[model samples]
Target: MTCRVVQWATGNIGTHALRAVVRHPDLALAGVYVYAEDKAGQDAGALCGLSPTGVTTTRDVDEIVALGADCVLYMPRLCDLDVVCRLLSSGANVVTTCGEFHHPASMAAEVRDRVVAACAEGGTSVHSTGSSPGFISEALPLVLSSTQRRLDTLTVDEFADLSYRDSPELLFDLMGFGRSSTDLAGRVAHAQAGFGPSLRLVADALGVPLDALRSHGEFATARDTTEIAAGTLRSGTVAAQRITVEGVRADRVLLRFRATWYCTTDLTPAWDVRDTGWQVTVEGDAPLDIAIRFPVPLDTIASVTPGYTANRAVNAVPVVCAAPPGIRTTVDLPQIVAALG
Candidate 1:
């Protein structure tokens, strides 16, 4: 039973989803969704640097949805309520890479409500997952809890160098940095402000209320600004962000997340606890530290394949997609560990 798939967006994540669909025996390429007018009517394969899959990109989302795809994998730019409602009502299940699902109740309140109602009326399903808040934020901690006797704290750090990325917005747009120190200060003041959903997941996982959460910022820049290889990015500047969420009742830090981005390639990439790699630590009666490095593949296209990140997204899909039609959080869904086929 090949799952017919219509992938939205053509960015890094979207490219990975498209490739996975092409390679997966259980998935079928149905169509590609592009919001940009210039990219409309283009070949999905050519746009993503793959051989043609015969699925042309389309701006007519309704037409694509009506084509009878079993599922729509949305990896494109964020769409509004009208579009979301239409997609849900189309009777196809949905999985997105957008952060909208991080906290369906917080940032996307109206969209969530509309989706829930639409899914009910249309008898469909929808779920959203991503690398940062989705996998690192939700899945990793859950994985750590199964083996440990007592769980004290869970920390996740993402160390990525966006210097190879071709977008200037990659700095501010994705990483949430600023052009200057003052601008960055303002940004940091509200950095953790949008993290309600991620924190909610942690709280739900631990069965506790979110008591206190604080975030601080540090900035680093390269010696020079305009000569980086991917593009002429300002040198001597980077954003190092740390976010902490504490449980008041537990009197301990439940979830700690930190991400640092370097504008250039000269500096070393490392994390505080594990140093230069990814690690999950569970400290209790039986202490445990699980360390794994998500190797950044050399090829640009191959790098976006979502390796560990996909496992996180794919693992969560069954829970959310098969879940009763409604807007849900990590806590709202049944707690289950991921298993490989």
Candidate 2:
């Protein structure tokens, strides 16, 4: 069953989604939503640096949604409830890499209610997932817990070099990439966004209700000035950030999710600085520590991140299209079988 997929917001992850949609044997690139005026009217494949696909990109959301795609690969940098609702109202099931309701139950009452209303109105479904908070934080932990007799602490630590990315907002604004060392404010910038819902889903999967959930942040200063695809990092500035979210039971940390993202690999004591992509630590009667790395071309790990997120969303299109109406999580969907056949 080849699913008709629309690529939404051709930036960052969306660009990768564009390529994935056209290439997947079980998926077809029905259309695309172009945020930039220059991108509109361009062939979807050409836009993503591939052979020209017949599907042309459009800036009008209504037009793309009206194309009646079976599912939308919603990988925009930032997503909003209204935008998601608009897509759902058009009766297109949505599979997102990030932004809006990784776990709908963890969302605010009004926002969740409206999203549910839209889904009900159009009989569509929505699923949000990504590598870290989506899979590594949710699926990986649940898989490892099956071997645990007495579970203590489960941690998912992600380390990535940000110098591989070209987005200024991601490097500076979202991550505080080049900020001063004393800027604690920059450290906690992304601590509160999507981690809470992720922690909630993780706790739910483990069958352990958390007494509390907490956010923590720390920084690694740059020893010298450095330049990256985003911009320049001044000496003594924030080159790396370690942000964490933990689900605690009775004051003891049960599930801990930490992301150590840096611009340079030369930070102090360089944690998780190897060729490995991510590390998942499970501490219990049977303690386990595993490191995950993608054997991609050298110096392309950061650039491959969007592909990781993009594939997760694209591969879930058939599942999301088959799911019942309303917002769903990775916990709610079945295993994503790559439609390589």
Candidate 3:
């Protein structure tokens, strides 16, 4: 059976997800969902630079869901609880890109309960997935735990270049720091804060309460001047930031996660890390160190490859959409890993 999908946002993430649906044999583009004001009347294909797939974009979730779309992939710009609730309660399965859904701590009590209840009431399933929040944050740890031993600890580190990323807002506005750094104190706040929730995700996946988890973070800026071929800006800019999250039970750290995003120049061997490489250390009598690097072509937005980030979310849709409705986490769904052909 083909799954009809409604894309909620048309931004980089949404567009990529849409493209994935268009290419997938198991999924079909039913309709596109945009914010009330942003590109409401445009064809979904035009906005994403794809050929018309007979899917028109609209701002109406109720009407769209009623159109026989089996699932809605939400990519709201902000954590809009109302729209998410509507999708869940309408008996349409949902997958979102909002950071809040990826990390429940980002949601308030009322909104969280509302989403959970909506899913239950509508017999619909709701889930969120992305690069960090989805696979690396949740799936990787879950994969490691398969070894089956007296669990000691797990650590996941991410090294990325902000300039290389399609969205600069994640590093600038959200992190709350300029591109350059002048103050020696390293005082600028982070914009694309990733580590905190990443650690928490690992904890949640491991079924450990955060009561004993300890979080610590440190930010750093480029000491020397740096500039990317794509953008303007000289020295004294915020270069990079590092954050670590350690989950502990009974004063012993059980999980440790470190995430670092940097400018291209500040990134040593930037090309290598950008592709995908991780160090997994297991502590036991013998101890073990494992490195996993997923390789694909380096070009961004490849026509044939779709988008890796989008695939991470889209590949999970089957399990999420088919599951019993409710606000579910990665643990709630079948293991969805990004595979290469």
- Would you give me the overall lDDT of model 3? 0.66
Sliding window of 10 residues with minimal summed lDDT for model 2:
181-190
What C-alpha lDDT values do all the predictions have? 0.61, 0.80, 0.66
Compared to the true structure, candidate 3 yields what TM-score? 0.79
Range of the 10 consecutive residues with the lowest summed lDDT in candidate 3: 183-192
Write candidate 2's Cα lDDT for 184-271 as tens digits: 5544545546677787787887678888888878888777888888888888788877888888898899988887777886675455
Write candidate 3's Cα lDDT for 203-249 as tens digits.
66667755554455454554455554335434455655666667677
Q: Candidate 1 residues 277-298, lDDT tens each?
A: 4566667666677666645543
Model 2 CA lDDT for position 32: 90
The residue ranges of model 2 lying beyond 4 angstroms of the native Cα positions read 163-180, 186-189, 222-239, 263-276
Please tell me which predicted candidate would have the highest TM-score against the true structure.
2
Return the lDDT, model 1, position 75.
67
Model 1 scores worst on lDDT over the 10 consecutive residues at 267-276
Error of 3 at 136 (Å): 0.5
TM-score for each candidate, following the candidate numbering: 0.77, 0.89, 0.79
Error in Å for residue 244 of model 1: 5.2
